[model samples]
Target chain A: MRHHLILRVVTKLLIGSIMLFALYVQFHGDYSPGGGFQAGVIMAVAFIIYGIVFSLQDVQRVLPPWLVHKLSALGVLVYAGTGVVSFFTGYGFLDYAALSPHHPVHGQHYGIILVELGVGITVTGVMITIYYAFTSRTPVMDDEAW
Target chain B: MLRTRSLFATVMLAGVFSLLSALLFVTLDAVDVAFTEAAVGAGISTVLMLGTLALTRRFESPPAHTPVIPLFVVLVTGAALVYGTLDMPYFGSATAPAQTHVAPDYISRTPHEIDVPNIVTAILASYRGYDTLGETAVVFTAAVGVLLLLSGLRRRRRKEEEDV
Candidate 1:
C-alpha cells in the first residue's frame, strides 16, 4: 500500500469528501434520515480508510489516542450534563423546556441538537478507538502476506 | 460451506450477509436501522475481523467437542422464535397493536410538544432521552473494554525488550 501510487492519490481525494458527507449526515439528521450514529460511523470509515491506505501511525498522528479517549468520555458528559442543567433549573431530568423559558419549542430544538451532538461525538470517538485498538495490537505483515 | 471455509472467507460471507440485511432494512422502510447495520455490521466489523486475522491464525482448528448439544439448543431457539412470530402482527400493517398503542399520542402531540417534524428524532432525543443516554454509555463502555484488552500488548512489548 505504501508504494501503491493510485491508492495513495485516491485516498487523499476520498478522505475529505467522506468527512464532509459525515458532517452533512450529522447536522441534516433532523430533517433527513440519518443521525448521530450514522454520522459517527461514516466519520470513522473516513479515518479507517486513511489508516488502511497509509499506516496506522499516520492516522494516530492526526488523532492521538489520548484525544480519542477524552472525546469518548466527553460525549457522555455532555449528554448527562444536559440533564443536570435542566434539573437545576427546576425542571425534571432532560426537560428541554427549561432551556428557553420564552419559547419552549426553541428549547426542544436546542436539547435535541445537544443530545444528538453528544451521541455523534461518543460514537465517532468509540468507533475510531475500536479500530485503533484492533489495528495497533496486530503485528505488521508484508504486503504479499495480505 | 462456512463450516469448511477459511476464517477470511467466513468473515467475507458474514459481511455479505450484513450488507444484504441492510438492503432488507432499506426495503422495510427502516433507513436508520439500515444505516447502522451497513456501517457497523458490514463495514467496521469486517475490518476488525481482518485485523484480528492479522494477529492470529487464518484457519480455524477442528472442534474439540461434539456439536450435538449446541445444535439442539439452536434448533429449539429457532423453533420458539418462529412460533412466537406466528402470533405477532404482520410487518408494517396499519392496524397493528404498535400503531394502536401510545404511538398515537406520540404522533399527535409531537408536533406541539416537541415541535419537531422528525418524530423519530423527537422521540429518541427528547421523549426517550434517558434511554439514548444509557445506550451512549454502553457504547462508551465497549470502547473502554477494547482499550483495556489491547493495552496489554504494550506491556508484552516491554517484557520482550527487557528479555532482550
Candidate 2:
C-alpha cells in the first residue's frame, strides 16, 4: 500500500506534465505534433492513469460519474450546436465563413477552437467514463467448495 | 517466476514497437494521427489491457501447434506491401502526391471559403460535416449503451433485494 501510494504520486505528477504538454500541443497544433484529437486523448490518459492507480471510486471523488455523463453529452452538443448556429445563420451546416463575413479568418479560428474544445471534452469524458464503468463493477470470482 | 519474466518481456517489446510506430507516424507528417496512435494505442490500450489481465488469468491453454498456412499468407502479403513502398515518395516529401493533391485544395480553399486559419476544422466541420455528424452519433450511441447496461444491472440488484 505504501508502494502504491508512491506510485500514485509519481503517476499523478507525470499525468500533470502530460496534460500541460497536451494543452501546448492543442494550441500549437498547426505547427507542432499535436491537435484536438491527440490532446484530448492525452488528457484522457491522465484520468485513466489516475483511475488505474487509486481505484475508480477515488477518481470519482474528483470527477463524479454524473458529471462525466453530463460532460459527454455536452461535448457533442457543443459540436452540433456550432453547426446548428451555422444553419440558422443562412449558411449551410457548419459553414463558419458565413459566421462573420467581415472577418472570415477570425470566424474560422473561433469555430475551430470551439470544435476542438468540444472534441477534447467528449474524448476525456468518454475515456474516463469507460474506465469507471469497467472498474466499478465487481469481478466474477468463483470459489471452489472444500 | 518464468511466466512473470515473459509477461514483462512481452510488455516491454510491445511498448518499444508502439513507440517506433508513433515515430514513423510523426515522420509521415500525420501529427494528429501520430498523437492519437501514441496516446490511444500505446498509452490507453496498454493500460486497459493490463487492467483486464489483472482481472483474469495470465495464461490460457497453450496452442498445440502454430498455424503455418495462414501465417505464411499474411507474411507474404505484408512483404509485398512493404516492397511496394519502395516506389513511393519518402516520408514528409512536400512534393508527394498526397501533399499536392487533396491537401492543397483543402488548405488553400479553407482560408478563402471558411476564413479559418485551422484547415482541419474547416475540412471537418464544413467540407466534411456529414462525417462529423456520424462521429457524434456514434459517441452518443456508446453513451446510451453504457446507460442501458448500468440500468439493467441496477434493476437486477433491486430484484435481488426483493427476493432477500
Candidate 3:
C-alpha cells in the first residue's frame, strides 16, 4: 500500500465524489432511480475503497466499529419510530397522514424522506461493519501478493 | 467460468456476470434494480469475495465426485424453469396478472397521494413502509449474526493462542 502511489492518489481523488454521489442518490431518490439502499452501498464503498488503498486501521479511526454497530441499530429504530409516531397520532401504523394532519400528501413526503434516511444509514453501517470484520481478521498481505 | 480452477478468476468472472445482469435490468426499464445490482452485486460482493479469497486458497481443489449427477440436476432445474415460464404471459404483456393487479391504482393515485416523481420510492418508503421496516430489521439481524460469529471466532482463537 505504501508503495502503490498511483492507487493511493486515485483513491483519494475518487472517495469524495463517491460520497457525494451517494448523498445525491439518497436524497434525490424521490425523483430518480436510486434510493436509500443504493446510496448506502455507494457510501460504504467509499470508505471500503479508502481502507483498501490505505489501511483498515486508518478507516476504522474515521469510523469506529462500535459506532458502526450502533448506527445499524439506530436506523432500524428510526424507521420503526416513524411508524410508532403515526400510531400515536390516531392513524394506522406507518400512516404518513399522521405527520401532516392538514395535508396528507405532505405527510407522505416527509415520511418517505425520513424512512429513506433510516434505510440509508442502516445499510451504510452494515456494509462497513462487514468490511471491517472481514479485513481485520486477515493479516495484511504484501503488495506483491496480487 | 465452470472450467476455471483459480478462485480469484472465478470471483472476478462472477463480478462480470453481475455487471451484465445489471445491464440487462437497465434494458428492462428497471433502473432502480439495475442501480442496486450494479453497486451491491457487482461492486461490494466482488471486493468481499476477493477478501474471502485472501483468507483461503487462491485455487480451487479438484472435485472428487463425478459431475454426472450435478449436471443432471442442473439440466432438470433449467428445463423446469423454462417450462414454468411457458405458462406465464409474454414479457411486457398488458394483460399480465401483475400489470392488472394493484399496479394500476398505485400508478393512478401516486401522483396525488405521495406526489413523488419516483413511484418506486413512494411505494417502497411510504406505501410499503411496514415491509421496508421489516427488511431493515432483517439487514440489522444479519449484521448482528455475522458480528457475533466472527467476533466469537476471534476470541476463541485468542484463547487458544494464550493456552499455547
Candidate 4:
C-alpha cells in the first residue's frame, strides 16, 4: 500500500467526504432516504477503507478497540435510558409524550432523534469492532499474495 | 455464475446481485432499503468477503459428491416460492395487507404526532421504539459474539506458540 501512491492519495481524499456523507445521512435521516443504519454502515466503511488502504494498525490507532467496545454498549444504554426517562415522567416505557409535557409532538421529534443517534452509535461501534477483529488476525497471505 | 471455480468471482457476483436488488428496491419506492442494500450488502460485505478470501483458498475444490440433489432441491424451492408469490397482491396495491394494516395509521398520524417529514423514521424510532432498542441490543450481541470467538482463537494460538 505504501508503494501504491495513487491509491493512498485517492483514499485520503475520499475518506473525509465519506465521513461527511455519513453524518449527512445520520442527521438528515428524518427528511431523507437514509437513517441511522445506513449512516452507521457508511461511517464504518470510511474507517474500513482507510484500514484497507493504509493498515489495520493505523485505523486501530485512530479508533481503538477499547473505545469501540465501550461505545457499542453505550448506545444500548442511551436507548434504554431514554425509555427510563419517560418512566420517570409518569408515562409508560418509550412514550415520547413524557419527554415534553406541553407538546407531545416535539417530544416525539426529540425521542426519534435521540433513538436514531443511539442506533447509529451502536452500529458504527459494532461494525468497526468486527472489522478490527477480522483484520487483526495474523494474515495467511501477505500484501503481494493477492 | 455458480459454475465459476474462483471464489473471488463468486463474491464479486454476489455484490453485483446485491446492487441489482438495491436498484429494484429503489424502483419499489423503498429508498431506505435500497441504501442499506447498496452500502451493507454490496459494499461492506463484498469487502469482508475479500478479506475472508485472503485468509482462505481462492479457488474452490471440486465437490466429492454430485450436486444433482441440491440442484433439484433448489429448483423445487424456487418453484414453490414463485408459486407463493402468485397469490400475493400486485405491486403497490393500495389494499394490500401491509398498506391496510397499521401502516395507514402511521402514515396518517405521523405528521401530527411526530412532526417529522420521514414517516419511516417516525415509525422506526418513536412508534416502534422497543423494536429498535431490541435491534440495537442484537447488534451489540453480535459484536460481543464475534469478539469472544475471534479473540479466544488468538489467545489459544498464542498459548500454543508459547508451548512450542
Off by over 4 Å in 4: B153-164
The candidate 2 chain A region of ten consecutive residues with least summed lDDT is A137-146
lDDT tens string, model 2, B79-162? Answer: 999999989998778899988989988877865666645566567656776686667667666766866774355776799999
Full ranking by TM-score: 3, 4, 1, 2
The better candidate by lDDT, 1 or 4, is 1
In terms of lDDT, model 3 sits at 0.92
Error of 2 at B127 (Å): 3.7
Best by TM-score: 3
| Alpha-carbon deviation at A122 in model 3, angstroms | 0.3
lDDT of 3 by residue, A8-98 (tens): 9999999999999999999999999999999999999999999998999999999998899999999898889999999998999999889
Clashing pairs in 2: none
Best by lDDT: 3
Candidate order, DockQ descending: 3, 4, 1, 2
Which residue pairs clash in candidate 4?
none
lDDT (Cα, tens digit) per residue for candidate 1, span B36-61: 89988999899989988998888889
Report lDDT per candidate.
0.89, 0.71, 0.92, 0.89
Residue pairs in clash, model 1: none
| TM of each candidate vs. truth | 0.93, 0.80, 0.95, 0.94
lDDT tens per residue, model 2, A1-146: 34466887799779889889878766665455556667767887777777767666677888888898888788788888888997898877766655676887666667767776777677777777666666666463323310
